[model samples]
Target: MEPLAFSFDQPLFQLASLPITAGHLVAAAALLMALVAIAAGRRARSLRIDERDGQISALLAAQTELQGRIATMAEVFGARQAELNQTLSQRIDGMTHRIGASISEQTKATHENLRRLQERLAVIDSAQNNIQALAKDMAGLQNILSNKQTRGAFGQSRMEAIVADGLPISAYTFQATLPNGARPDCIIRMPNGQPPLVIDAKFPLESWNSMRDAPDADRRQQAAQAFRRDMEVHVRDIASKYLLPGETQETAFLFVPSESIFAEIHEHFEALVQKAHRQRIVIVSPSLLLLSIQVIQAILKDARMREQAHLIQGEVIRLMEDLSRLDERVRKLQGHFAMAQKDVDEILISSNKLTRRGARIETLEMEATAPPGPSEKGERAVDNRMGQLKLRVVDED
Candidate 1:
């Protein structure tokens, strides 16, 4: 038993006017179906293409309107930017001007302050120079006071200066030798040839300095006692050496160079002062010495005035005598003037008498020369009588 073989070439059906086999029919059917499908696809493709063209046109119109709106917005933004730039430039210029003015004012103020500071520095420099000079002077003064001999010279110089300034050169003498050969520091010549006033310039300042520099009270007390003793001894020496009978004054002066030291002695040591007074030793500072010199000067002036009193009186007497002589001469001149005036009066009276006699003679001559008229004889007789009377008047004048 074999199975039947199926083949497309085996004819199973007939077609009009063509060889109709099963294979051919089936092939025809396949071809027809493919053609139908191709037609449907073509129709759908045409419709889709039309739709795409319409969408493209609408999109182009909308893009054109959007571009116009963007251009308008860009123009507005540019105008606003220009206005902002102008405002910013103006504000910057104003700010720059204000900053410049502020800087100028600050510079001026700084210059003024610097000038004032320089002036103050100059003044301070001058004061510093003065202070340095004063310091040097003080150092020199301390050096001079350190040594005993120099210290005595300093005191003596100070005393001499005071005396020289207050008195004439001849009135005071420096280092005058006495009768006993004891030389004193200075001797003021008294008025009217009295004894000279002796002054000693040597003072013991070492004990005073020690007393002042003592740290403890006991040491200060011991120094004070030593100073008092030294002062007493110096006073005794002055009294012994300078106080001379009929040579120097009864009292002698102990010159203290320093005013503060003199004040200290007077304030702290009353007993020492009293003892010196009893010893006829007078302690004198520069001011006191000057005062005494002035007193001596006044006394000298008074003595000079008294000594020249007789000369002044003689001058006054001579002036009075000269005045009396002048008065007598003036009286003689007045008497001569009176006699001259009387002589002038007598000459004036004689001139008036001569003028009257000349006028009467002229009148008589004119009457005699005139011619006689109707009563010639009587007229002639009257004229002769008048002529005789005129002649008698002239003789009397």
Candidate 2:
């Protein structure tokens, strides 16, 4: 059945005025009963809409309370914002100050470091100049060593320099004659002042230089043979010239070629070394020479030290004489000083005695000027103590 739309102001009930026959009256009654059921269903729907409206009003009141809470929270947030801003400003200023202070300190430290570095550089510059001058002098000295005429002086100066670095120069003497009547280059004294040990520095350098200048292997080999032969002859000659019995304590030293040449001789010629050793001639290279000079320098230094002891003993005797004279003079001065002190003491005694006499005279004068006391005014008619200053009845009174 289809239901009709209902309006609240208009009544859903309707009355039908009808004229009907006995058979149509029942059909009309059934139609009225169907309209009553539709009206009841519409009324129930309206009751449900009223219940929903009441619930909506309660929801609106809750929304109003929540808005008031939001407004209070906003005010509190505004005050907190102001406090946070103040604290943030102070922190920013402090941080800025700390950053600035750190920057300033770093800059100052850097400046001080730079200044110190610059000062050190200046010192280094001065030291560099001194080093340069020393190097130049050394180069000039080395240049002088290349000449044959100055070679002896070179060898002597170099050897002396080496010895003087650790050993004293007084240990050796210039040009000593061996027992064989041959003069060696230099000799150092023994501790007992015996004949010094012999060493010869003169060697054939031109021939070695000639061998160095050879171009081919054949020429070089020939030069090598010549150089070896010359060395053998040199060794024999040195032994014959310097090695003699009762001349020196040790075998004579034959100073040879440079270190390289000495190395070559040892590498190539063992036979020559044995022959030379048999002849009592030991070839010394530069390194070996250094050791020899040290030994020789020690021996001579000990001898000189012994002589210096005698010299010192003589000086001590002279000093004792001077000390005796000095003591006599000191005694005379002490006697004079004592006399002066005694005179000063006597003068002080005389001054003290004069002061005591002046005090006594002042007392006598004061008593004469003062008037007589009332107790004994006319009793002293004899005037016995006219010039005397009286105090009590003890003395001449």
- RMSD (Å) of each candidate, 1 decimal: 17.9, 10.7
Q: What is the lDDT of residue 181 in candidate 1?
A: 90
Candidate 1: the clashing residue pairs are none
Tens digits of lDDT, candidate 2, 1-397 = 8999544444334447643443354455666666776677667666766766777777777777777777788778877888888899899999999999999999999999999999999989989998999899778866764676676666656554554564555556657666567877767656674766777776656567567789998988888788778877887777777666677645877676368878876777788778878887787887888887777666666767887998989999999999999999999999999999999999999998778767866775666554556656443632435534453323522
State each model's CA lDDT, in order. 0.88, 0.72
For model 2 the local lDDT of residue 68 reads 79
* Best candidate according to TM-score: 1
- Least accurate 10 contiguous residues by lDDT in model 1: 364-373
Cα lDDT tens digits for candidate 1, 1-397? 8999888898776667556777887898998888878877787777777777777777777777777777777787788788888888889889889888888998998999999999999989989998999899889888988887888899999999999998889898998899999999999999898999999999998888889999999999999999999999999888989999999999999999989999988999988999999998999999899899999999989988899999989999999999999999998898888898888898888888778777766876676555666887978787788878777986795
